[model samples]
Target: MNKEALKKKLFTEIYDTHWLKLYLHLLKMLDDEDDAKDVVQEVFASLWNNFDAISIHTSFTSYLYSSVRNRAINYLAHKKVVISYEKAEELRDVNFSNAPDIFLIEKELAFQINSEIDNLPPKMAAIFKKSRLENKSYREIAEELDIAENTVKKQISRALHLLRQKFIHIKYYLFFL
Candidate 1:
């Protein structure tokens, strides 16, 4: 089969084999059927779009599972932020003061955190996400990635250091203005 044919075949095989399991796993994580279905659909859609460039460090199943898990985490985190902002807006019903400040703080914090994560070296960023975003212990991350626990620790430490510098600069910049 050619590259195009292989990509199409692989996507079909994987989607058929994994879709239900992925959906169930996401349902367990998200506790809502619609959200679970949406996340699973997104995982497959991403796989389809990036099929040519996709790389799997481990088994394809592991990669698929991790992708769904990460997507669910991001969705829940965003949902939490939305809830917080909505609550803040409700508070604005009583007082309009500082509404923009609240929004600015929310937007700034999320942007800084996401940008810093994206800016990290790939290995460091992956380790950091496994640790912080997935809430995996150092040992767990190490085992999952087949690396030393100390390496995991060091990568996470480096990530934290870089993020701290970025945040400190942001704080000073905002404070001055």
Candidate 2:
């Protein structure tokens, strides 16, 4: 199917399945029916705008939740600014800590880790790549490389440790990373 058709399908599916829940969530949080509907529309609009480029690392519901949350925070901030004439800095205490942009980071980290793995010591790289990229078992990799199973396991473990150290900063986001 074409992108247009896929886009329509996605829009319909998400709207059908999640629109009510999302609207209700916004209603509960923002406590205004009009504001809830408006933000919900904005969320769907953004989703439609970025549909071609958006990659869902988790469930579509979760992706929608994060997008909704960020949008809601912005909405509330703007509303607060309008209502109280307060600076944006005053509302920095809002709970916007949970939603990190994961898809792009996951893609970039995979690229970096793949490059790093390719640059590993030849034997270890081969083993690690076979185990991960080729979905080979330790027994199969060892047999193909004429190495012991224990050796294969050790090399893979070492390769993993090195990769972990290199990307240690993202350890906190490992669930989606």
Candidate 3:
């Protein structure tokens, strides 16, 4: 088989063998069926995108399990951030008049961010927008643009790097960085 076909076949075998087990493991750890499913899907998607560069120091099963565990941890971390942001939003709403300056700062920060994203190279900006604003997976963005997933990932990474450099002075918005 050609390299691409062989790669796809190997990926299919790995998915067929480990997907269910990974999902079940996550389900046990997370105790939420939907969240577990999402995490498993994300792990597999990441594996597919970075397949060529992946190095297995141990068994494939071990690698997959580790990926799933890390993704679940990140998922939980993001949930915590969302909850915290919601509470902060509520407090800000209660003291809207007193926090007008804070609100203005947030607006300016957002504007700066958007301007920076727009300043990225055209292809990088497009991929970054599809990945972040449209919430598309790297695989989805690659397929849609008829480019490699690695290209999509690299563009997004570069875009973020540039944005971070532009906003390095804005320490309070570290979440974006």
Output the worst ten-in-a-row residue range by lDDT, candidate 1: 91-100
Q: Model 1, which residues run further than 4 Å from truth?
A: 96-177
> Which structure is stronger by lDDT: 1 or 2?
1
Candidate with top lDDT is 3
TM-score to native of every candidate shown: 0.52, 0.46, 0.53
Pairs of residues clashing in candidate 2: none
lDDT of 2 at 33: 98
Q: Which ten residues in a row have the lowest lDDT in candidate 2?
A: 90-99
lDDT of 3 by residue, 100-165 (tens): 577677798889899999999999999999999999999999999999999999999999999988
- Give lDDT: candidate 2, residue 97: 37
What candidate 3 gets wrong by more than 4 Å, as runs, is 97-177
The whole-model C-alpha lDDT of candidate 3 against the native structure comes to: 0.91
After superposition, candidate 2 runs with Cα above 4 Å error: 86-177
Question: What lDDT would each prediction earn against the true structure?
Answer: 0.89, 0.86, 0.91
> Relative to the unseen true structure, what is the C-alpha lDDT of residue 100 in candidate 1, on a scale of 0 to 100?
46
